[model samples]
Target: MSHITETLNQRGNRYGEFNRHAEITQNIKKAMQDSPNWATLKPWHREGLEMIAHKIGRILNGDPNYDDSWHDIAGYAQLVEQIVRPPAPPVPPAVPMQNPMRGAL
Candidate 1:
């Protein structure tokens, strides 16, 4: 997921340009080899790790892309959109100690 996070961050900075998941996966594999802690990542987590790496790559390389292409990438672009262009109004914070079944309409 770190890879995904990194890719997402890059995508936001670059304003969405590239979508190289394979290269991202390679980076993630290298990262895992370098850091022993990466062994704990589950199989599912490893699934889209490349996508995340793409984001990191963009960040490292600096966002050279324009804003128009940001929405074009496949795989978790919506999450990227949220980071780049946040919703108009953030959802209201939940009330403390709110009963789960209180609103029995």
Candidate 2:
């Protein structure tokens, strides 16, 4: 499995309960909807990570206005993972090369 998939799975296993928590889920959705333009404004990959880190720090620091829960953090991390390690492209089948001099040999 890929690193991103592994990380996501591990997080899911660890915090699966929050996935079903109505308040947490709603908070995550609200946070995302409130910041719709952040992704477009900060197009750089690193900028995205920094933004997530900033919000996480706010939560850790007990910022009352920043109501993002662990679920929100995980969602942001998953987004970053998707951006950093996108799915691999499908491999094309190999074609047999004809040897012009094979019969001539």
Top lDDT hit:
2
Give the per-residue lDDT digits (tens) of candidate 2, residues 6-75.
Answer: 9977655544533354344456545764685645544545455555654554453344344455667667
Q: Using alpha carbons, what is the TM-score of model 1?
A: 0.31
What tens digits encode model 1's per-residue C-alpha lDDT throughout 1-105? 799999877755654434554455467668865786657865545444545565455544455354332433344555555555755987899878978788787
What would you estimate as the lDDT of candidate 2? 0.58
Candidate 1 Cα misplacement greater than 4 A, ranges = 1-29, 62-105
Q: Please report how far candidate 1 places residue 38 from its true position, in Å.
A: 2.9
Q: Give the root-mean-square deviation of each candidate in angstroms.
A: 14.7, 13.1
Backbone clashes under 3 angstroms, per model: 8, 0
